[model samples]
Target: MKKEFSGRVHFVGIGGIGMSALAQHLVHCGYAVSGSDRQVNEQTEKLQKIGVKVHYGHSEQNVKGACLVVRTSAVTPDNCEVAFAQKNNIPVLLREQLLGEIFDAFKQRIAVCGTHGKTTVTAMIHHVLERCGVSHTAFIGGEYNKSNYFFGENIVVAEACEYNRSFLNLHPTICLCLNVEYDHPDCYKNFADVQKAFSALFSQSEKVILPSELQKMCDKAVLFGKNGSVQAKNVHVGRGTTFSLYSDGVFACKCRLKVCGRHNVHNALAVFAVAKLLQLPLLQVSQALAIFCGVDRRWTLHPECKFNVVCDYAHHPTEIAEAVQTALSMCKGRVFCVFQPHTYSRTKAFWQQFVTCFDGAQEVIYLPIFAAREKPQKGVSSFRLAQLARQTGLNAKYFSTFGKTAQHLSKTVKANDTILLIGAGDVNNLTKFL
Candidate 1:
């Protein structure tokens, strides 16, 4: 916490997952907090219940009499409240900047950064640390159970995002990079640019933990993978995964995770490495991780009438592949995937990769792209992606509306079929109708 100004803070995009968590934390810290967003949702409703004044739409008056203003990456410079705050000579800070200030208050700060699985990894570490009775605070990117942020003391754990190099604003004594891959095409030019950002984040940390695949990039990093410092051996993947964790060629502990997917095993590997580095109680950490149901929208399962519906926030090509693979492993019958491309830039950038990602799905339905923080680009749409997917000989089709898609699925889907809704957007809401 910076002490220069009084604790009168205003958030620009308050309804966002990250922004709402930050608002709750500030209110818990005895600050006078208020915010404005374009729409009202469950997050905004929660903020209101917690005594944070929230405005539905952006307005110049929303920032009046605030000591400072915080904005998410999605908020543009031309936003009404942001522009008004600047005109009034008020201090305007990005959300990551304020998060860095909050992190500076703690001695042990852990930041989990990667192209995917940051939310799961952060939540896993938080759960383990909490079960071990470690005094810690966590700021997660997605809603975990009920809240996105947990309040504690002495330590802070947060999900570090790499879009626009925002993770650089964080101060992490221990940094965990799950895996570096090309993402956020709207920001980075190529894979090298993405790697450079992760390298910059690694440079700021006193200790770094990453997968074995990236060990060559950072020799000093504590690695975890097929042949890393910490390894998951004798792995079994079923309704869940069971594996023996080894640290430096010695059997450390036997672990089981309720979460599905081989990707989650890799996520658990990173968490186990962190626990070992921190010297937390191994038995308790493993137990807590075993019962971890996972964060919202990360392979969350809803058992409908006869068929099953699984929701996942897999917007990237690699994540989509892993998600489909996980669905295939869990489904007893055919796998039906309803995918919504998150942004136009990403769909355009990873077009070729996206074409082959649905290889494991029996049927693929394309919903309209969810344009988050970006305008539609020329020659970029879900229809084109659907056509490309068909070129790869996958059973793919494009539906312009969710209602029509739902109606079609209701008639075509049968018992024992698993419907996987994959995206980082509102596609998860479709599960309610299904």
Candidate 2:
């Protein structure tokens, strides 16, 4: 199907980050875009401001007179609009299929994919391109500089998600594969199933860039990490991070980032490798890297709070550990972690890992799990998680709601203490109480 289409295009679950970005892109291209969601939020409001018609709730009529209907993976076939579209013989497309078409239109396409850090790395690349005055379009997974969709010239930079093997849809000119790990248990049966998807991605791409550890996955890939083709050595992490970047065994330049963490150091290295492949100016790239603040909810700092409070989207076990460590490294006082598990399947898959991840936190406050699209699983819950954590010798407590959690923190937390609100769901809303 053609990327460019006439007539109205409707999106089911348009409030989603990826869906909103795509809708924004289509609107910019002059297509009549409409979308439906259960409720109006930031994404829908932004679309409304830009003249994209939005419906509050889904209905059969919502899909009427549309050239095509695009639905997020969460939207089942039984959805009213989706059913209507099919009954009326209208073409229906998955979100990723449409994204792939849009991506295919670009002459220079970069698709960044991994279990973690895709959003930050994608945004970093966007900043580099913007700083260099390169004409490019970017679809970031999270809001960067307060926007997820940036329209520019032909070059396209997109955050490729691995869930449901969605990243396989877009055939990119350059595929930046960050470290791969087991995730999306609902989609993949095992770790090897996850690796198989990345291998397929490497096979279809013209160029592949990865960390030194994953070099064995792709023979033609360029490597980044310690002792790789591109490296960030002598790392220093505080309010921010600085490192010496070396490319192909030669010193390239010193890089500094406003974002703190060794994970971000690896993220920057991936960006540097992409810059090198694109033949961008290293000096300018380093400067751009220094100035990039970071994406929203990825260690987002709330200065209004009496104490330092950080809001982060770290749901996976590996991510939780890294985020807690990053918080511990920067805070002079005790670190208090307020965690909400993202999905039941994930929590059940990595139960032990989750219990042990908050090793260094002064206290772990657990909220109800965010069951995004899954029903509650037996023997999998935040309460059990807290119990396991306590058994592990970590101070852990379970709060059934946001109010109680906030109340406990307000009484116990003191000056200089840091509160970390960590999750992938609505748990971030706890920030209003803090």
Candidate 3:
């Protein structure tokens, strides 16, 4: 093992969900950890509770005592802390590289990858395995209610993000490519460029599982959406989606979800296929999924609100559609869809696609792009998205703030209507008010 930077590690962007989880894991593993982010967030506060010194912003002082300084993909040499690390000759590693090292320690590391539904699938898999008495650790992208079981263990399960080629560093024992799609136009040049990275990872894996749609993308992968391995046939969605798993033949099947969505059924099946491949009992997997409450800020409810309200971390075209359609399918009345585009580049690049994703909403509301790591492009705004949706024959509108969006929804949404606030961004915070 490389022992040059074993004493202390400082994180450059610790407020992010992935960054915070990694920080926690390192602290739990007996590493001296500290970090810096743009602002103080709940995640940073949590890290502080665990005795991690979190600096409010990046600076040379933050990395003072660090033998190693880790930076997120968004961090560049221009970042004060990162530059300081270089000037001081501190061993610097990308976030993925640090995760790769930790993941390498485990024998059964499972990585779930795709353009969308990765979070749900990761949570489903984690839930099933935990219920089946498997001692495993998970680094999910979102917050999950399985608090007692959501933790680190002998087996490391994590959501492998494709942004800036982060997931490529992971060494997975059972790597799951959920489904492939074009995204991250900011980082990757185009769809082919993104696919190239996935192809390389799947090519190197011992057992690669993927949706059948990606077969042409990676020849060696074990396809799942339709053909080679696990297939969910006769899919039905109501109360929850239930479908039979067919490999050589069909198996008697049913699934129940507190969450409603067609995509989630597919997610559950992905979990089933993986667990069964690992020799986990199908019955145990089903029980776990049925009992699993959906992840936090992912279709969560507000306490005082009589109308149905859900908070989801969905921003991509595919993700937005799933959230809206799921809310519509489960509700008795109209569905109000509120969206916050995640980044300027993504909103600009996938503009047309986002317009068509909200197929089932009775009304649509948009918030300014979250701008995860990019400055705003002048022409890219939620109003543009609203206009795009309007062209698609949907009732669309835009708001600059969460308070305004909530106010509009309060007046517009009826008693029986279900409101879905969707985005990977801070749009979910709107739920605190209404």
Check candidate 2 and list the clashing pairs. Answer: none
Given candidate 3, what's the lDDT at residue 94?
87
Q: What's the TM-score of each model vs. the native?
A: 0.98, 0.98, 0.93
lDDT of 1 by residue, 1-434 (tens): 85456957999999999999889889989999999988899899999998999998888888999999999989998998999999999999999898888887789989999999999999999989888889889999888878899998989999899999989988788999998899998899999999988898888888999898898777679888778878889999978799998888888889999998999899998998898889986778889999998999999887753458899999998999999888888789899999999888998888888778888788999998899989989898889888988887989999998788888899988888889999999998786678
lDDT by residue (tens digit), candidate 3, 29-139: 788999998898778888899899988866788898899888888888779898888998998888888888877678888888988877778888888877888888888
The per-residue C-alpha lDDT of model 2 at residue 260 equals 89
> Best candidate, lDDT-wise?
2
What TM-score should be assigned to candidate 1?
A: 0.98
lDDT of 2 by residue, 1-434 (tens): 25556799999999999999999999888899999999989999999999988999889988889999999999999998999999999899999999998998899999999999999999999999999999999999899988999999979999889999998998999999888999999999999999999999999999999898888999999888866778887889888799888888888898889998989999989998999999998889999999999999999998876667999999998999999999898998999999999999999999899888987999999899899989999989999999988898989999999999989999999898999999999987888888
Candidate achieving the largest TM-score: 2
